[model samples]
Target: MWELACLRFRHLGVSVTPSRCYRRQASSHIYIWDFLTMKRLLGLLALSSLLAGCASGLIDPNGYDETGTASYYGAKHHGKKTASGEPFNQNALTAAHRRLPFGTQVKVTNLDNNRSVVVRITDRGPHTRGRLIDLSRKAAEQLRMLRSGTARVRVQALNN
Candidate 1:
């Protein structure tokens, strides 16, 4: 049993000289613990730095809001090409903002009744002058503003 255990430790690269096994057991145990400690610390350090790098990609969410008129487009615009090169789908939660980047996501809040919906920016207009953002049929439905065709809204960009 002793021989087998010594051989197993050797196979694991933990040097255990046969002559010193009985005399230096405590010293060898200390050496093994020190080696393991270094390996664990290096692993922890690598993991922490990787997580920090990922955390740095996030942005502050304050000051991303815009208050203005919101509108929706349905059937005719569905299946049509959007400015983002994707086909518009009325059932999807999407929107169009004149100045927002094509793939940005914004939270559209109906200021009149305080209802809100998150929509992805997939197209580019209200083309009608005073409006701020054009939401898809589904987004409008979520905001409960389909009947008025337009609503006072607050559009806020999401950092993620």
Candidate 2:
């Protein structure tokens, strides 16, 4: 029984001390307990892998891939907490993304007039559904979208 127990653990890649196994009865209940424990351990490992895969910056946001209008918020909302937990900076050339990590640089091009500006993502969201991004007031000025408050644009994710 002891030899068989050692062989089973070796096959499963688990190292169990001989002293501990020798004290336990070679019963059906013990086998069930061992199977349940291995299943639980494997489940935890799989869950951890899934969480790691969900971490940010895994997806690229750059190139001529995304096109839309961009708008900015400022003055009344300046210094307010953004979705990424950072304070909004109206003067900074920063923008917001729905999923991109904070500090990602994106090139935003105004498709209507062919003007483009690179802005860093320091926050999250344009909030409104269907909107691609939210830029700071300064970024809006750079893109010349302040007059109309929004412009048709293309946003590409830049390499770090």
Candidate 3:
């Protein structure tokens, strides 16, 4: 019983001791509300940090450029509806961006092999945080990134 109580306290990021056991002694009981307040504060801090990162969220086709890791989608999502409400085609010269508008065309260059491909933005998101773009399986092949499954790429929006 004591071990279980200690484990619970530890999971909550609290230290526990025999003398601090609440059930054993009324006076030793720690107010549950104090821990609840701590939990709430910690959660708020995390949320704020997440929101702060979204300051540069959108990828603009004009004057927007960035260098980051790129990945691709394949057979598993070959025909699923994407965020833009269009069916995903793993073989098309299509890609997903975090916020670049649908129908926007961008050029993705694999930094590893210097291979490049211009792909149209057909969907929203790479889903994973910190990733800049997600290419289709066919695009990945053109960049020769199919074997490694991912590559460092420079994404640039093309002139409309």
Candidate with best lDDT: 3
> Pairing residues by index, what is the TM-score of model 3?
0.63
Using lDDT, rank the candidates from best to worst.
3, 1, 2
Instruction: Give the Cα error of residue 40 in candidate 2, in Å.
Output: 23
Top TM-score: which candidate number?
A: 3
Give the Cα RMSD of candidate 3.
7.5
Please write out the lDDT profile of model 1 over residues 1-160, one tens digit for every residue: 4555566568767767898676766666666668768999999999999778646644444557889999899999889999789999999999987767667888889998898898998887889999988999999998999999999999899876
lDDT of 1 at 116: 88
User: What is the TM-score of candidate 1?
Assistant: 0.61
User: TM-score ranking from best to worst?
Assistant: 3, 1, 2
State each model's CA lDDT, in order: 0.83, 0.79, 0.84
Per-residue error for 127 in candidate 3, Å, reads 1.2
Clashes of 1: 0
Query: What TM-score, computed on C-alpha atoms, does each candidate reach?
Result: 0.61, 0.60, 0.63
Better model by lDDT: candidate 1 vs candidate 2:
1
How well does candidate 2 score on lDDT at residue 2? 70
Candidate 2: worst-modelled 10 consecutive residues by lDDT = 56-65
Q: For model 3, which pairs clash?
A: none
